[model samples]
Target chain A: MSFKAAVLVFPGSNCDRDCKVAVERSTGGHVDMVWHQDTALPSGLDLIVVPGGFSYGDYLRCGAMASLSPVMAEVVKAAERGVNVIGICNGFQILCESGLLPGALMRNNTLKYICKPIELKVENHNTAFTQGFTPGKSVWMTQGNADGNFVADADTLNAIEGNGQVVFRYVENPNGSANDIAGLMNERGNVLGMMPHPDRAFEAELGSDDGAILFRSLMERVAA
Target chain B: MKAKVHVFLKPGVLDVQGKAVEGALNGLSTVQGWANVSHVRVGKVLEFDVAATTAEEAKAQVKDMCDKLLANTVIESYTIEVA
Candidate 1:
């Protein structure tokens, strides 16, 4: 089965192209680059990838301005319709700011930008974004961001933890995020928001090809 | 009406920026009382004009804006002032 995915492109979304390439290479799917102001997403999208970057110049806060872009309205609608959605790095921040997912991505506790390959343990492999990997498998990916610390209220933390909403945890904490969360999925399991840069890890030359598993998993779901 | 909105991170959420600033202030031993500064939280102010005839109306409108966009209510609290 042929899968189709849309990659939303905000003003400062530098990683949009990388995400497109990754999806096309990993999933063998057609990828469309959607502008933030387009006001609509392509119909029948099997997946929506909100790629990493400092959208809107990281104005106000990372992803805050981009979250309000017209296209996000359509993205929210698609998510509600049960289409698979993945937000990476600044994209994750945008998802949280848009209220599609719980919590926020605050500044790193170290107050410095961190760019390095890191290991993440797949905490919940049942979701469409992680089903390609075995349960509790450890994967390598690149993380490059300044405001990647994930935060939430105590009640929300408890609820997400108890519900198995956390999909990935850092092997070694990098940004002081609550519960060392690197990736999280919504309760419905159709949407995922992660701080790491999976697009950057598309090949072993880039450090790891483990990120392909996510796109591959989505493709399998679409084919199924 | 002219409105000013102040956004601040809630208490309990670690303010790394504020802590860094406090550390710098404390390092300035050349200035008296700089060392005594504590809990030096940092926040942001946004000023804009709205089409409201009364201050109450402007305040309410700006407060709504704060709740919607100017602040992330999950981690930040906002105060609105209108003139």
Candidate 2:
């Protein structure tokens, strides 16, 4: 069985091509680059990636404008149907704004854009994306964003923690996110939103190959 | 009719921009009471014309806009004014 994936592209999305290449190389899957205004997605997608960048020029809020785009409506439906969905960086902000994920990505407490390689602990290995990594293993990836600080109310924090939906935690807590959460999954575990750029780190020469394991895990699941 | 929407970060949520502005303002003043600013919160205002005939209708419509897009209610709060 061949794995099928798609990378959604918004107007200001700079990482869409990188995400497509990473998924294609890592999973050996056919990837479709879908446009934001397109109302429909290619049929029979196994995974959907919301790539990072300042969508809609970060006009109102980081991801507020792009979340309401036509393609996101279909993306939300695909997520509801249990297709694996991953959002990275500004994509994480879009997912949160769209209500596909909980909480909000606030401005960095330091009020400066952060761009660096950071260590992330694999907090949950049971999910399809992180199954390739050992439990609690530390991995390296790049984080580049100004509004990557995550925040939610008390009840949401408690529920996500208790449900084991926290997928990854930052080792150094770069953006003042609550609980050091670098990544999160839905209660169903099929949707993930993270700030780090896994696609950017999938190759060894680029920095780290740890991210390939995530795509390989999905490929294995899709092949099965 | 016209609607004005004010969006603000919730009280408990940190307003980093507001804090920075407050700090800058305090640094510019040396008077005893001039630097007494506390609880500085930054917010945004969106003003737009609505096709509603009545103030109540315009408020309701603008409120829907806030809930759907203008404001992310998770860490932000919004107030609507119609004129």
Candidate 3:
């Protein structure tokens, strides 16, 4: 079966191209651009990506506005149907704002937007998204903002921990995120959201090819 | 008529930014007799007014506005008062 994927493009999304390139280059297949206004996604999409950027200029709050777009309603429904959904950076923000994932990304505890390469450890490799890499390995973070801390209630945190829904955790806990959480998954394990942009580091062209393994992992299963 | 709405992260949700601000304040011994304080709570208040005929209408409208736009119901809850 040929793998089909769609990348959502909001008005302020800047990373859609990188995300599409990552998927296309890895799978050697076409990646579709889905606008945030469209009420429906193209049929048979095996995966959907929400790329990072200041969607709606990070207005009201990060991902808060974009989550309400008609496109996200479809995205939420798709995630419900067990479609593989991955949110990166602003995409991660949207997933939280849309209630697809847990917790909220708040301003960094440093009160400054951080843009640097930071190491992150992969906590789980059993999901469709992170299956390509070994669990407990580190990845990279490319940007920062004050509102980047992840927050959730204790019950939600316990549930996430109980189900092993956590995907990535910071070794150094950069943003002071509660429990050092860097990424999350839905209860069903189909939806994954994280702050680091795997798309940004996917190739040697970006000087860090550590990102390729994520897409490669996805393609490996699709091609099998 | 204009009404103001205050939206903030609820009490139990961890306020990292607030803590950062508090940390900075605590670091400043001259600000308010500093050094010993270990915590500070930070929150944002968004003030906006809407045209409504009465207080009850204004309350409902402001609440809806908060739910839909002003406040993120997941991590934050909002309270409104009309004057």
Best-to-worst order by lDDT is 2, 1, 3
Listed per candidate, the RMSD to the true structure in angstroms reads: 1.1, 1.3, 2.9
- Screening candidate 2 with a backbone cut-off below 3 angstroms (N, C-alpha, C), the clashing residue pairs are none
Worst 10 residues of 2 chain A by lDDT: A128-137
Candidate 2 per-residue lDDT, tens place, A164-212, comes to 9999999999989999999998999889999999998899998898888
| A80 Cα displacement, candidate 2 (Å) | 1.0
What's the residue-level lDDT of A159 in candidate 3?
91
TM-score for candidate 3, residues paired by index: 0.87
Please tell me what DockQ candidate 2 reaches: 0.94
Clashing pairs in 1: none
The candidate with the higher lDDT, 1 or 3, is: 1
**TM-score, chain B, each candidate:** 0.90, 0.89, 0.81
C-alpha lDDT of all candidate models, in order: 0.91, 0.92, 0.82
- For model 3 the local lDDT of residue A46 reads 79
TM-score of 1: 0.98
User: Candidate order by TM-score, highest to lowest?
Assistant: 1, 2, 3
Residue A50 lDDT in model 2?
A: 97
Candidate 3 residue-wise lDDT, B1-83, digit = tens: 66666677787776666777777777797866777776566556777667878989988888887877778876787778887
Comparing 1 and 3 on TM-score, the stronger one: 1
Stretches of model 1 off by over 4 angstroms after superposition:
B30-33
Error of 2 at A59 (Å): 1.0
